[model samples]
Target: MARTTIGDEPRHADYSPCEHAVTPSGQPRDPQSACPGRTTRPVVCNQHGDTTEAHHF
Candidate 1:
């Protein structure tokens, strides 16, 4: 495949927030209230995906 020029790199500037109602961790996309204790939410990204572990079981 032909390589893309340095100046031709794809842009994420146009990327919009995911239409997801909630994060993959089940937390609200836009949190309205705080939980009682510590939160163990997974950090999700389009490039890398969600974290494997937060707190030890």
Candidate 2:
């Protein structure tokens, strides 16, 4: 799988802000293992100055 930095623009065209999953390392989680009933909130990185969203499973 490809890895993205904190400020990196979304590589996937299907990027959705309403739902997402992130690991403890602050990386996007694998879709197959993601939780279905989880809700995500937007994430902001001060160092990279980028805005993103993440959820927990």
Error of 2 at 47 (Å): 25
Instruction: Give candidates' CA RMSD values in order.
Output: 14.1, 13.6
Clash pairs of candidate 2?
Answer: none
The 0-to-1 C-alpha lDDT of every candidate, in the order given, reads: 0.37, 0.43
- Residue 51 of model 2, lDDT score: 64
Error of 2 at 13 (Å): 16
| Cα lDDT of model 2 by residue, 1-57, tens digit | 444344333322333442445665445577675434223343445453436444221
lDDT of 1: 0.37
The number of clashing residue pairs in each candidate reads: 0, 0
Consecutive 10-residue window with the lowest summed lDDT within model 1:
4-13
Off by over 4 Å in 2: 1-18, 31-57
lDDT of 1 by residue, 1-57 (tens): 543222112112233233335554545555664422223333544343443445222
Per-residue error for 12 in candidate 2, Å, reads: 13
